[model samples]
Target: MNETEQRRATQLLQLARNGDAESLETLLASYIGYLKVLSHSQLDPRVRGRLSASDLVQESLLEAHRDFTKFAGTTTAEFTGWLRKILVNNAARAVETHLLAAKRDYRREYSLDLLRQAADESHARLNSMTAVHRRGPASEAEHQEDLTVLSNAIEKLSTEYREVIVLRHVEGLTFADIAIRMNRSAGASRMLWMRAIEKLREAMSNENHE
Candidate 1:
């Protein structure tokens, strides 16, 4: 975030810390898109038909709201970090819940710990995509703000393109896995991802200019 935006977030943080419900609502509401991106990026597509990023985000926000009084964050980065932990836990639960409902044997299926680990890794990697854009103080805050911008650009893409980008970049899925999920040949998936990245780049460029 810019200096002005960071200051604004800090103000909101203070109000939230003081139990201002409206400020808390406004502060959390601003992160809707960000939480969506994180949840969507980490949610395994195998279980996504039964779960949704929006639902996960809602659950995370609800949990955050309930625990807001316990939060000690004094800045946006710290607040976001706390929220992300909840998001990952929720995501891990979603994976376990859906897989079990699908009648998968627990012994054969991936462990819940693995699910959480993957979610954590994916979250970090996705943020790294934005983090690489700059380096210095409050870089993480800048990373998040850039993610908001990047998320906006990603949303404008065609569903096909967006899906490819999410699987390949956000979720760190290999082209082969993406192909299996998308029901396309590996070569086709690669081509789609290429196109998706190109479109995303153009969208980001447009956003930068605007």
Candidate 2:
């Protein structure tokens, strides 16, 4: 997010926290793309086909809306973190419903902790790629804005570029694995990934300038 966007978000957050229903709706709507990306990255592969990221994100957003009054944090990062927790929880439930419906020891197969850790790892990787650091302690709002910016940039890429980026970065797949998944040679996968990164960087650069 840029300065103008950040200021707007802060204003919306304050209004939402103070019981403005329309402001709350607007605030949550702004995060739909970011939430969708997080939901897609954190969803378990076993249940990817069974559950769509949009559905998971919608569920989470509804829950967030219902519980917005309970949220006490004052920064965008805290709000984003709260929403991510909801997304992870919903994703874990989806995984269990689809992948462990018949298993008696389903708990052994999956845990919310594992999903949360995966989300954290993905967040760290994305932050490393897109974050611009300053000398002093960076504010939480700045970190959250970086994520929002990156998510929007990713959403603007071509489908093939987006797929390669999610596979290589979000999923942490090796080039060989991505090659197999994408039905290309390892060298070809690497090339595609390079192109995807270049495009992504350009998109992010344009976003920052805007």
Off by over 4 Å in 1: 1-8, 44-47, 95-98, 101-104, 107-112, 132-140, 205-210
Model 1 alpha-carbon miss at residue 38, Å: 2.7
| Candidate 2 least-lDDT 10 residues | 129-138
State the lDDT of candidate 1 residue by residue for 1-210, as single tens digits: 443344355577788888788888877876776777667766777768978888888999999999998887677878887888888888767767776666667524456566557666766676776666557644544555676667767777888998888788778889999999899999999999888888988988876666
The whole-model lDDT of each prediction reads 0.75, 0.80
Q: Could you tell me the TM-score of candidate 2?
A: 0.84
Top TM-score prediction, candidate number? 2
How many clashes does each candidate structure show, in the order listed? 1, 0
What's the CA error at residue 198 for candidate 1, in Å?
2.7
Misplaced by over 4 Å in model 2 are 1-6, 104-106, 132-139, 205-210
Sliding window of 10 residues with minimal summed lDDT for model 1: 1-10
